[model samples]
Target: MKILLVDDDPNILELVNIHLSQAGYEVIKATNGLEALAFLDEELPDLAVVDVMMPKMDGYTLTKRLRAEADIPVLLLTAKGELEDKEKGFLAGSDDYVVKPFEPKELLFRINAILRRYDKAVDTIIEVGPMKINRQSYEVSIGKKVLLPPLKEFELLSLLSSKPNHVFERDFLIERVWGYDYEGDEQTLNVHIKRLRDKLPEEVKIVTVRGVGYKLEVDAP
Candidate 1:
């Protein structure tokens, strides 16, 4: 998914960007709330990560304005971790809150949880070939054997298996799996595809179409 990250600190921006990108989310950066607002005119992201304190405009006001215009989820990221600060964040229409100096894994987990709740409310267990993917639990297994894959790999596999044998172009796959805001090159896609191939069962194969795209083709039982 695409996430707008609004922060004044260049260090914080770079840190969050690296972690979020590694976790498979496309990130758009804004130095402050005003810059973030300008970005809204161009394209709306799936979610926004706003810092509580910023120049030009604070996160609360940005979140309020965002709510006034769009229905996207907003996450407040700042050093304020007190109850009152959290309450204020919610009052500003933020869907979640994360304190600064937080664990990258924790941030990623929260992002996934919020997106799962916002995007797909219902739980679904997708069974294709030998793999069973529990959407709600974010677990993938083949009968008794469980497969633990990185975020990008899991997303790529889930998407390809969603529609078996359907030829999905490279651009389409990147857009759906990585979001339009993705800044990574095509090499990232190739790397994730390789990881998924190595992890998935032999029967579950991702077939490549020369100069076209990819499809999930399952071997016969």
Candidate 2:
């Protein structure tokens, strides 16, 4: 998952970035709301964590502007803890709120909850060549027929399909599809990759980079 962290406090931004990165999430940093908007122009993140107070744009205004442009989830991070403050955050289109001076673990927990809620509502359908991968439904289909891929295979396919031709390093795929603490070796990943290849469409190929990693090569539509 990718998270955009917007805060005026350099210390807080660094701290949050470090924690989220350690937890296996990609973190993009912005010093203020205007900077965050500039980052958004380049690419949209999976989620945003905005500070309530800032120089150019406060969290509330940023949340409102973010909602106007994207459907991604926004979480307000602030020092305010009152009922009205939280209500204001929600009114500005924030999906969740976390007060400052909070435990890093608690913030991570809230982020996970917000993402789960978003996954339920967001249409996470990726179309590549002739295949469609519906992430929420955990269904992979070509035309009208669904491919019953095993759990690990499904995750592997989804990860590869998510980025189309982007190459994923061997170790990176294992860490993502399996777990960060996975003890298995590369052979396990190769076995799963072979199975995925057998089940996938002929036009879709999991190409191996000579010494780098693997990437999905989809035939033109």
lDDT of 1 by residue, 132-221 (tens): 987666679997998767777777877787678887778767766676567889998998888888888899998999887899999989
Question: In model 2, what are the clashing residue pairs, if there are any?
Answer: none
Residue 172 lDDT, candidate 1, scale 0-100: 62
* Per-residue C-alpha lDDT of model 2 across residues 85-125, encoded as one tens digit per residue: 99999999999999999888678777867865675566588
TM-score, structure 2 vs. true: 0.68
List TM-scores for all candidates, in order: 0.60, 0.68
Best by lDDT: 2
